[model samples]
Target: MSWLVTGGAGYIGAHVVRAFQAKGIDTVVVDDLSSGRRSFLTDDERFVQGSILDGRLLEDAFEKFHVQGVVHLAGFKYAGVSVKRPLHTYQQNVAGTSMLLAAMEAKGVDRIVFSSSAAVYGTPDVDLVTETTPKHPESPYGESKLIGEWLLADQARATGLRHTSLRYFNVVGSGTPEVFDPSPHNLFPLVFEALLDGRTPRINGDDYPTPDGTCVRDYIHVADLAEAHVVAAQRLDAGEPIEPVYNLGSGDGVSVGEIMRAVAEVTGIAFDPEIAPRREGDPARIVASGELAARDLDWRMRHSLTEMVASAWEARRSAPVDNV
Candidate 1:
């Protein structure tokens, strides 16, 4: 039996698929190529071109691959744009999750590892966020993810579904040159794109309360995050005890100023960032403690900030001009 990874053709999803392959576990990718790239998946890997909103397609893939579990990563994942398009976000994240769960139940796939986000805790009031941090999602995307977690919990209570949701903030770096983040909204790609185009990258704000005067947020390597998903799946396979959620976070966060400096150092492009007005709802600091994940999933920051910057830059530089 194989694990079906929704959105496996996307950046983080592709890394998760590779991690499963490295552990000798078969994986089947189901993606609609909406924001994901088809070339990210290898020719040898099993792939079903479709969307999770299509329940019939999910059911068919589950049966065709003999899927034993699912890694649910397919969803509308832009917290900022979600405010302007709330309905679309709910449809893709909330309704889509409901459909996928129904398909899993029909196919007897009793295990799942959900891709959650730190957006669930909008502008957390504490210095370090934990699993118990009160959820006050500020955007539609955040609300949809929180609803997705609730859907998983509700389903688990009704059925014997074994599941866990992994929450994280900025997921950066590339495990392979074949896969690089193509997000137009992410900070790394934004800086890389600006540098490649010879435009000085801009920072949203520089007057925040952070030591560096810019906002601070957690960043984790994509490969490390991918490995944690595999371990969570293995635990479910072994019928081991697992929590309903885990935060794959860096206890301490790095400032936006620090990231800009890292980019300059890594790319040999020395230029100060242009400081713009702070975006609405921007938080000065938001970091989480991954101590729980450390004990349960062997989660740790295996890569440094320099490694994250260098690897992402190398991969982004290697991508085709049109893709960049």
Candidate 2:
């Protein structure tokens, strides 16, 4: 039986797929191509083009691929846009997850690794977040993810389903040159696009309490994040006891100012980032400790800030101009 990776054609999902394959585990991809590109996947992988919201389509994929477990990564992920698109976010993240779980139950595919978000902690009051941190999500996007985790937990208790949710912080960098982040809202992409279009990159706030006078947030490499996912899947497949949720975070975060400096250095384009006033509700620092994940999922900061900037810049440059 193969593992089914929902949204496998997307950046993080694609890296998860590769990590699974490297461990000699077969993978099947289910993506609607909403934001994901088909070119990001491999010919050797089984492809199913459909939305997880369609229960029938999910049923068909489960049977066709003999799905053993699911790596559920498909969802409406932008926390800021979720404010205006609350219904869309809930439909895609909360409802879509419900549908996927139902399909898995029908097929007896009892294992899943959910792609959750640190957004669920929404402007956490603490300096370093932990798994037990109280969830007080500020946006519909974060609420949707928190609800998704609840679905998994409820399902697990009712039907003996084995599952884990991974809470990801600012997922930056590319695992391979073949794939790049396409989100219009992400920082690295924004910086790269601005530099390529001959516009100055802007920092939303420069007077924050951070040492560099810019916002500091957890930034982990996509590759390290994906590897942790695969490791979690392996453990679940082996029926090893694992936590219900893990945060893939960098204990100490890098500042936006430092990121800008690295970007300029990596791209060989030296220019000061335009200073814009802080976006309302923007926190000075939001970092999480990955201690739980490190103990259970082989998680570690394998890439430094310099390496992340360099690799992301390389992949962004290598991607075709029309791809983004």
Candidate 3:
């Protein structure tokens, strides 16, 4: 039996699909190709192109592929845009997850590993966040993810479904040159796009109360994040104890200024980032303690900041101009 990965054509989802494949686990991808690319998946990989809101499509995929578990990553992912379009965000994230859960119940798919967000802790007061950190989601996107976790928990309590949620901040780098991050909203891609187009990369706000006077955020490699999903799924499949939620994060964060410097070094481009006004609702620093995830899922920051930048740059440069 194969595991179904929703939004498997997206960057993180593609890496997760590959991670499961590396462990001799089969995967069937279901993506609408909204923000994901068809080329992100391989020819041999099973793919069903449709929105998760369509319960019939999900049930058909489950039956046809003999699916056992699911890795739920399909949703509207942009926080800034989510603020302007709360209705669309809730529909795609909340309503879509509800539909997927309903389909899973109908098809007897009883396990899931949810792709959650660190946005659930909006501008946390503490220096280092933990699993127990009080959730104060500032955006509709974050609120929807919290709701997704609630759905999983409530479903598990009622239907005996085995599930876990992974909350994380910045996901950077590429596991394979074939699969590069194509997100227009992510920092790495935004910087790379600016550099590729011979434009200066702008730091949102350089006056924050950070060491470098810019916002600091925990950054993890895409491959590492993908591996954590595999581990979470394995624990569920093997009936091993798993936390309802785990934070995959770096206890220490890297400043945006530091990131800009790393980008300059990696790309061999020497240009100071333009200082732009801070966007409203932007936090000064938001890092998390991954001690629990490390203890449970073998989570660790395998790649350094320089490695993260270099790998992302290499993969970004490898992509076609139009795709980037």
Q: Residue-wise lDDT of candidate 1 within 245-282, one digit each (tens)?
A: 99998999999999999989999999989999999888
Per-prediction TM-score: 0.99, 0.99, 0.98
What's the ranking of the predictions by lDDT, best on top?
1, 3, 2
Q: Worst ten-residue run, lDDT, model 1?
A: 315-324
As for candidate 3, its clashing pairs are none
What is the C-alpha lDDT profile of model 3 across 50-138, one tens digit per residue? 99999999999999999999999999999989999999999999999999999999999999999999999888899999989999999
- Model 3 alpha-carbon drift over 4 Å, by segment: none
Score candidate 2 by TM-score against the native. 0.99
Clashing residue pairs in candidate 2 are: none
